[model samples]
Target: MVKKFFIFFTFIFVSSLLVSKDITLKAEKEKEYTYKDKFMWLWEKIHDPKSGYLSVEGIPYHSVEKLIIEAHDYGHHSTSEAMSFLIWLEALYAYFTNDWKPFEKSWEVMEKYFIPDKKTEQPNMKYYNFDKPATYVPEYDDPYKYPAGVIYAEPVGKDPLSDVTARYGYEMYLMHWLIDVDDWYGFSKYAG
Candidate 1:
């Protein structure tokens, strides 16, 4: 009787060990998705191929439409973040697949939207002077202090990058912060 009991206990322990090993193997299999595939998932969720990521005039709404048409509000931080992620995703895709078209396309889209073109957007940039650049405005800790206190009377140093920026047709390869999309508040509320 004692010998039979010992044999039965050993068989049960071995069976459980095999079952646990199988379960672990299955779990690992489920996580076998490549890093590139994982990155693609983010693009699938937020991007529209035709319109390109819930945008307005090529500027992503941070991502809300003017009339709450979509689900976001205008913010440079949000759009910049999304734009950056898109470029990185495309870069990873190119690395994994060795197809660089998508990566180039991502950069093109980012430049077209965020970095305003010189001739079209900056008409008066030619008049810019390094010595008399826009008045200096110090960063304020208080929220209400801003869009005021522009410190016009105070003298400011000459622009260090004026020479370099002039080579690019006086156009800055930078993305300025946006307050709204489609001029929703201005033309709709102020005009007409």
Candidate 2:
């Protein structure tokens, strides 16, 4: 009788475990399915094909580090932090959607103009060499001289490190699971 009771309890426990596992997996799949639909909408709304960067209202504010879209022609310059968010967002979007084209395009633009020309410069500082040229220009007929800084004249100013540091931290923290551990940078000592 005791043996039968033990077998019955074991069977019940195993069955409950299987059922709960199925439910959990189904919930996750449902969540992803919903997000996939919304991702397409977000892509259409935020993507700026002309500049290869997300914009406030279909307008490119390349001059400033940041820009705020206003109701009228009134707005403020966006911070470098905004661009950093966009980079991380783009990577996250690609990871979820399995689409690398947009991420690749955006990264190319950022790498050219924003990824710092020297170690002394801010990580995400916007300054490309005027003499040379970037590989991708959304639309430009001139020699493509925007603005940049050397070791001293960094555009983002005294506190230029925050945005870049945040970006690197996120990339290093998450990309290991999404991509490859080898593809990501090591944990930043300066993140503190």
Candidate 3:
């Protein structure tokens, strides 16, 4: 009777340990799923391919038509705000879907327009109206007078290194992480 009780107690102890470990692992898996679900929900909500951008803040416009029109009209061609946001969105979408095609498409468009000339090292922020050549349009149509590399905060686009550059730096850091991925965008070490 004593031997049987001892064996039964030992079995119960071992079984409880195994059960607790399984429960912990299950909880961890559930947590991961919950995180993925939240991201997927945001992707569904803010991803607007028709507008060629993500809303970022998840502000809902009246309609998809309105979103597209707003993006087309107000989207900056040169600012890090415009380019980095798009890159971030594309990267997230690709990460979620395991599809690189969308990111690749956006990359081609961004490479052609958003990235400023390395020689000038300035963001010209030229708007490439899809199928048209990237062109800089100053308020007065005087591209030659506009400062080349610095981010201007003033109305005339002349002020350099504005407060918005902080946002740009952050976006660049995110892009560095997103694009540094292997076998996706072709691993390139981003020095900046």
**Count of steric clashes across candidates, in order:** 2, 5, 3
Better structure of 1 and 2 per lDDT: 1
The C-alpha RMSD of each candidate to the native structure, in angstroms, is: 6.3, 19.3, 16.9
Question: lDDT at 21 for candidate 3?
Answer: 99
Q: How do the residues 108-161 of candidate 2 rate in per-residue lDDT, one tens digit apiece?
A: 645543443344434433443322323332434555554422433323333444
Residues 106-156, model 3: lDDT tens digits: 676556444434444333433222233234444545677766543344334
Task: Report the C-alpha displacement of residue 88, candidate 1, in angstroms.
Answer: 2.5
Best by TM-score: 1
How should the candidates be ordered by lDDT, best one leading? 1, 3, 2
Candidate 2, superposed: residue stretches over 4 Å from native: 1-33, 48-78, 119-192
Q: Give each model's whole-structure lDDT.
A: 0.64, 0.47, 0.49
Model 1, range 1-192, lDDT digits (tens) per residue? 999999999999999999999999998986897666676776565556553454433334454333333334433223566667667877887887788987787687677666667777776777878888779788878888766567798899898778787676576777644323455445322112
lDDT of 2 at 92: 76
